[model samples]
Target: MRFIARFCKEKSEYFEIITIYDEHNEKEEISKEHPSIKTITIKNPAGIWFERKMHDDFGIIFEDAFDNRPLVHQERFPKDIHPLRKEFTQTKIEETPYLPYKYEEIDGDGVFQVAVGPIHAGIIEPGHFQFSQAGENMLHLEVRHFYTHKGIEKMLEGKRLEDAKPIVERISGNESIAYQICYRDIYLQATKQELPLSLQKRHALLLEIERTIHHLTDVGFIPNDAGFGSALSFASKLGEEARRKMKEVTGHRFGFGAVSFENSFIDIVAFNEWLNDLDKDIDFFEDWIMDIPSLWDRFDTTGILSLKQAVKYASVGVVARASGVKIDRRENPFYLKHGFSMANEESGDVGARFKVRLKELKNSIEMMRHFLEEDETVLEVAEICDGEYQSFCESSIGELFMSIDIKDGVIERFFARDPSFMNWQAVHIMMQKDIIADFPLINKSCDLSYAGNDL
Candidate 1:
């Protein structure tokens, strides 16, 4: 069983610990009076973060857990102040005395520590990366995030289904379409409404557009990190064109409000012309990058994540696919009908990841073309029944899982496990034995989202 997510929901007399796997789900009821349960991390290491987050939110103890350290709460946060508890209704709280965080330490004769960011020089989100190194070679890397946690899950409680769409769509700016589609799928499931085939095709097209934009950005940034600025210039040009086309088609550059029950119209002539130009430009870009031996010297075999480690960590998206794991969620008939093909690589290194993104970019372009060739029409909303519903989407990053509980026509509980949440855990594994200088390149290859993960 592949572990997916573990979360907790507060109840009047007890707390429910929900563990979700690929095939099945397990629930454990812990009395609120004594909210302690046995840890599953001994068997499934991926549960480490989940259990710790639950402890921070609901004060549910996972007894004998391998790592019981706080995952969400940082230093100076009050102890025993469970934010997600039903009784804790304050919107503001007082900070406690300074408390030092315990990061894993490595002591050796020449080993020294390098700490980077919770604040960075670039216009990016905050995340701390601590490195134990000996003369530029990284011995260990520990990543600490969640500095921008917005309490989104807690904010969703008691919100009407329609009112939650904007909030969910904005969870990650780059993944707006994916989140919207996933949320719409959950709503459809709860309301027992089947989206028209026409609308589904439109949604798929918008999704592919979003994927292409992000992949193009990554491919460009990867080369830029290697000191190849021309590739970034070319890629930025293409990405801007794609973003403009997105706005033309969906009335939003990021496709924020694109996935809905209403119909969306597209001009086939202009859209097809843009796609054709993009396809040719991408081909040229890929060939140009591949022929640059200097770039390959920096990319090839740098920051390797072995297949064994990938599976052990349950890595997803490009991280898993580049390591030869066939784990994409877009294998359904709809995608296949639209000429979808999974890209794979066995090297598990920077070059392999770059190539995978190139191939996926081409595949997404083709898929969008196929989807646009088909006819589409409008859809209508269905009556929503109050209950639980779950949905998944193959977002640009990887599989995005969302689950929600509806009670009295409003959201009672909402949980989302973004691809970044899974992929970020495996980055430290990739950094092992790599040089500190190449950290920027390897990290750009992964291109994780802090907002999505922090939420």
Candidate 2:
């Protein structure tokens, strides 16, 4: 563990840069192990007129350098280029020579390569998956992405404190609410702001609703991988109904405008009616899981990712929970006060992933009901303004994290880590020892966001 930091003052401009490098390469003693290199870089805006006290602003970036070396900074930067420096204006391009991305080479007579897309069958994002296969069994798989890179982080620069939420929400269309909440919390923390108790409950309710509905879509697709068309159709219908109910309450099928309370609030009577219907649908789905022996046969022991691999890859969210890795942010004291607990399954297979989501779905529903029943008069809102707010609440798919830096009453920088950003690599692990045909089942089990990853 090496920690390096320095402060430079030149011509009345101030700059501070901090870097931590792990010499032993040991995992951080946290609830979960993430595979990406951990790196921190912070840049505070310079100004002499600002009267506010100097505060530490931390920024963490995770990535690997082209040579497979551990790195946390931008992958596109050359060794000599320091783009974050104050003197650097325009981005210099083509300084680093192009190098073709390497893929796993399979040596044999029968082995062959199959290229699957920058386009796909579903209305999905573009990304290529190269598979090395011997007949039907896959020897290696490489995922190539960044075709849709939108430079989201760059776009955040110079934005007002209140104006960044919409851009953050657009990071992933399916997981919009989670992104919004995470970014909001980070900004609130940096600004020393707080939300009312009623608003907190509302925030949590949106999270659970997002989780339940998204899980319904993911788990429903698992059966489809096994040629169970009816199951997929049923799950999609229920999931769509859940979305419609959300739109009815939040004015967006994906819960778009719900983040800003000025635009929305949950109606208890209508929400209760919706929940009652949803509960019945869940019961039907549960019964189907129990009755269908083929479903079990397809999912059980399939896409088996060992607990060791889960830790090695730092898998988070549903995949990690299914593998018996207990890393739920909701267990943080903040959410515990709101009644949150970790959920897990030990098998770490497609079946285990499905089971974990089902169990979490139940937990979300229970939490929603409990939140709805809380006393309204006591649920006071907290002021959002310059303080650190770090609390854990669950997202529909997995844990979401954000950190914001504010200085002199202006937004300094914002950083967020989506669960998909780390867990996409888990797909390769899940593919191991499984045939090419099982790709859909294993891939849909994780249901990672390509846009989130590319960002």
CA displacement after TM-score superposition, residue 53 of candidate 1 (Å): 0.5
Error of 2 at 305 (Å): 1.0
Please tell me which predicted candidate would have the highest lDDT against the true structure: 1
Model 1, span 204-318: residue lDDT tens: 8899999999999899899999999999999999999999989998888988878887766689999999989999999899888899999999999998998988888778888
Model 2 C-alpha lDDT per residue in residues 1-455, reported as the tens digit of each score: 22111111111233332221213222232111221232322221111001000111111123322233212222443444333333445544454554345555576999999888879887779877889999998888876665675655545655666677777788887788888887766755654556777766777777787887899898778888788888778888888888887787678888775776442445788878877877888888888776889878889888888897777666678888999988776775656776666778999999898888888877777778766743333322254455433323346666665545544544454445567755765677777788898887888888888877665
Measured against the true structure, the TM-scores of the candidates, in listed sequence, are 0.98, 0.78
For residue 259, model 2's alpha carbon misses the true position, in angstroms, by 1.6
Model 1: CA > 4 A from native: 373-376
**At residue 182, what lDDT does model 2 achieve?**
78
Q: Which candidate wins on TM-score?
A: 1
